[model samples]
Target: MLALPASADEARRSGYDFMSRATRAMQDEDAANTGMLWVKDGEALWNGKAGGANRACADCHGDAVASMKGVATRYPAFDARMRRPVSLEQRINLCRTEKQKATPLAHEGPDLLALSAYIGMQSRGMPIAIVMDENTKPFLEAGRETFNRRQGQLNLSCAQCHEDNWGRKLAGNPITQAHPTGYPLYRLEWQGVGSLQRRLRNCLVGTRTQAYAYGAPEFVDLELFLMWRANGMTLETPAVRP
Candidate 1:
């Protein structure tokens, strides 16, 4: 019987805390422990001197100290060249093709997931930093609209479960506002770590939005909305969840 407030961000953060606690009770340390495997794989990929160019990620980035830090905190960001929103998966592929001169990994492939987990893990403890500069504001506004708009057979918007009824359990799980701060999460319910786009697609399916492509702009916009909403939460990449 709870209702969301005027500020959607506030409602999401408040609701997610309660929902996360509930989820912890339902699921255990599977995500937190198993999630590290992806990070380890990422370390290998980053250090491996593969490809014709003979360049490992460390060759250019050099140990993932500064470049890696705060990298994930700004993901699902707006792409100026594409003139649209882009997910971390898309960005990874682009970097692989453009910089690494290697084939892009599949959306849910191990390389992408590992790299995403590694990057996300680097930003641990960093507060999400979603900038709504002029270039990104339109996407931000669009995301808000998408989140609030009613759709699906049930005619339920994301706000309904995440904001309005966050403390209430649905299908044995408390509905959280769906924050992206700990993206590339490893959910015990899922049995593995998954990118935020993966998580967003899950929500769209749950809401019956026909589920956009893995890295579609719709998902990117939604990611932005969620991250922006969770602006102050600490990053918990590869975090445990039910």
Candidate 2:
């Protein structure tokens, strides 16, 4: 949360009043609150029984609160077990297919977002701690290179705007560091909700890289770089995003 203005404090105004205004400006209209609904859907998806093999995610993992606690904070991590860097999304799909015997959900599909939002919320308030273990270091390095690589017609890298010029308006929207502390964020512009990967894909199209297929290796690398960049920040899953 942004700090309440210091000047407002000295002027005998209630802090709550200032907070309300700050939050209100960010939450105008329908886009303000769609994340919770998505998260709720995720809860059901996690446990709802389905798929060709007649199996559900719950068949393998059980409860998300108990089983998924602290899982998100370490996500976009290098997975020695899998010999790949994994995002929370990837791990979720791993269990769904191998253990639960089901097809993986589409990248930005409701099932994916719901599970993402739910697991993300579990790590709320915990600092981001994605590890670059021996197996993952190359992936992390690749992701950083990809992040700095300029592609598409604009020939612009993510750093040009998000890293070097954060807080500046692009057309109209304010630029942030493209941090991943908030995943499964409710986006006002979409008037719905989505994952950090969804947002990154949007940027890719804008910058003109032939956007990667959902769950592609490059996307995983990008996720790792973002998680590492936001290390020590708390998860704000299902958070509001512009």
TM-score of each: 0.86, 0.83
Model 2: lDDT of residue 64 = 78
lDDT of 2 by residue, 1-242 (tens): 12225553243211112224544444333354568788788888877887666776677677778778888988887666888888788888887887767888888888888888888877877877886566777887798899899899999999898767766778875676677766878776787778777888899999887988878899989888878766666676767765
Per-residue alpha-carbon lDDT of candidate 1 for residues 126-163, written as tens digits (9 for 90 to 100): 98777667788788878888889888767888888776
In angstroms, the error of model 2 at 168 is: 1.6
Off by over 4 Å in 2: 1-32, 52-55
